[model samples]
Target: MSEDFKKKFDDVLNKIKRELDSIAKRIDEYLEKGEIYRAYRIWRDAVLDSLKMLRNALNTLGEEFKDIKFSEDDLNNIAKYTREGIREIVDKLEEIGNRIRELRGRGYLWIWFDLKPIKDLFQEVAEEVNVTMDGVLSHVEKFISSLEKAFEDTGRRASQVVSVRIKEKDLELIDRLVEVGIFRSRSEAVAFFTRRGIESSKDWIEKALEHAKKIKELQEAIRREIGGEEGEEDKENQGKP
Candidate 1:
């Protein structure tokens, strides 16, 4: 019976080692490839495997792991990290969203002038658009300032409530976006737009492209007019000479 138990224990240990090695390899590959989405998936699987291993080890020790309680400090620390990560992600997403909104407004402003009668365009719309743009840019400026202040405020107990809790659904939404190449990762998507003040809120890039073509046409027309005038001057000079 003693020999049999020893053999079983050795098998379980080997199985656990294999699981850990696989998890570690996955992590290394994800990190090397800079694949944040894959990294998160691997990390989650590793956590699940670790929990299972812990349970099995506890079982081997003749204790029911599920019945074991966590200390208050452990729970609190977990909550703190979880809350901080969620809040950071949400803040980044919102920053990207605000940028997209601003770009959409610019797109609309450009379109509103497209051969439309001056009388048909609402004066209120024009005024509101300007006001909204100012407001958003101002917010962006303030956010840059407050962002530093936020780091300072983090350790204050009063600011703990400011943390956002990211749920599994939030991560799922980001993962789907990542798969489509709209984002390399949730962090990249958030970082790219937040710094540039753009977002996936609307097809602003297409609109901007259209707007750019129109401006180019206008510039070419102006250049042709100037060239024509120069030609006319040359002709007059030739006749006078």
Candidate 2:
């Protein structure tokens, strides 16, 4: 499950991991220069300037998807990962956050001259962590939504063999694809183009679907109106002046 999701979204996940590493390094620098609290309005977190939490979070993210292949583009393999693996990641992050909050009450980072900023700094830091976590969750949600749509589209396209009656020119184009070694046979060429067309015009396809639904609703409404009028006419006729 983990490997499957990682494969489909390897590029995205790599970018995210790199970004995390960059951010972690920046925070480590802050801890080194003793500017941690200054930047955070009081006190804050870290990456590798002597910290276990930061290492754990970064490692958890990186180690899971290391050495992944981009070979599998199918969603069926990743559907389980979408549900389980994603939750595992989110849960790991939440665990890190919970640890931070647990330590927040200890006045560890509260070391200061007057100790007046302790409460404020702790609250601010926790709030920042929560906000960051929220952003992560939101990004995951959007990614999952995209995967779901892709899965739905794939399912529709791959349900059965579509017997399409093509014009000669279209058939010739399919044959050309085969001739160029782009596909093994006419069936492969057709399937590839059919999927490609759906993918390329996915937005338009969604809009068309929306319009079709509205059209169905409109037809139903018109039928209901006609039925109501018929009921009125029947009542009048039965009443017979």
Candidate 3:
């Protein structure tokens, strides 16, 4: 990976870590309230969703590190440990919440308070796992972007130029045609207007020559009008003499 990509990855990773911390903290607080199993169900769902994000982040890192020339042991370790740990904790929390619900229905007031501490423990563990996962994901995205750009640059450099040829007479005709707006320019006219088969015929060439003559006549007429205006001005000056 390039230095630029590394720097961007670090910055993004830090941000992800902070966001995960906030989410985990909120989850912890919600769990600690320990209302009924029905109330904690929403919290359970949220935690499950966050686990998906963590898993995705880990997968991205694994893929990114596969070809890199650095040690990814630490990353692999974190991902493996965090994924399993979070999954286990989530399962235990759900079980405890369910049990507390059963006890509450039986009029056992003690389970309600006991549930709160367990919820807090689950929340703290979640916070730590999420913070780490967030950082990893941000870096993964940055590295992927850099690799994509590098490959694109390589492709651009491999481009080759094409050769083209135009006859001198055809070139001159293109210029003349452009001057009269028959086409925008020689290249445009040749590219789009000139039919290869039709232009190859003597008849079509002759017709094009005729149009060229007509254009020359129009130019000459324009020149004569200017000359006639100048002559009129000269005569008017002589009349004053």
Candidate 4:
């Protein structure tokens, strides 16, 4: 990935980390207040939201990585690992939810004073989630590092290099485009847009010629009508004179 894209991806991961930290903090606050239900709700929502954000970040990173040509086996391994991680988190979340529901069904009111077993279960599950999240985060960082190294190695292997001068504003635009996954690099963006413009220019020319032809035909029809009317009028006048 380009520097701009890497920065954006890092921003996304940082936001997710902050959000997860906030959620964990809120869970602790609720638990301290003896509001077990509130804590549980917060935990559930946090897990769901975190998973969603992580998945989105992974997908975005995957798109960015596609720009770098990598081995199919490496790509497949990454995808498989990601899917397994998500699945494990989802399963754990579901298990926690089901345990909570079972306790609720058994007349457990979640009062802090007498709910030792439930509290223990909650803590256990929460710890597991924390561990899982940490693992996932670590794996993601490693994955990114590996990709970066691969990109560097690929660059080193390339035998040809081309340099071009670009205006500052155009460079900014290219960076934005790269950040948005429009192109892998400025060179790619330039090549793709140039090719598209060349291909579309031919189409545009053809359409313009078609329109010109239609206009010519219409003008000829109008001229014929006007000339025929004038000739008729002239003949009538000549006969009268």
RMSD of each predicted structure: 26.9, 26.5, 26.1, 25.4
Cα lDDT of model 2 overall? Answer: 0.42
TM-score of every prediction relative to native: 0.32, 0.24, 0.26, 0.31
Model 4 regions more than 4 Å off: 1-18, 84-241
Query: Sorted on TM-score, highest at the top, how do the candidates line up?
Result: 1, 4, 3, 2
Among these predictions, the greatest TM-score belongs to 1
Candidate 4 or 3, higher TM-score: 4
lDDT of 3: 0.46
Candidate 3 off by > 4 Å:
1-169, 193-198
Task: Please provide, for model 2 over 121-151, each residue's C-alpha lDDT reduced to its tens digit, 9 standing for 90 to 100.
Answer: 2233234433332233334344444433443
* Decoy 3 TM-score against native: 0.26
lDDT of 3 at 156: 34
Give the distance in Å from residue 154's predicted Cα in candidate 4 to where it truly belongs. Answer: 46
Clashing pairs in model 2, backbone N/Cα/C closer than 3 A: 37-42
lDDT by residue for model 1 over 32-113, one digit each (tens)? 5555434444444443454345344424532322233434343333223323332343343333223322432122111011
The C-alpha lDDT values of all candidates are 0.41, 0.42, 0.46, 0.49
Question: Candidate 2: where are CA atoms >4 Å away?
Answer: 1-6, 38-76, 83-241
Per-residue lDDT of 234 in model 2: 100
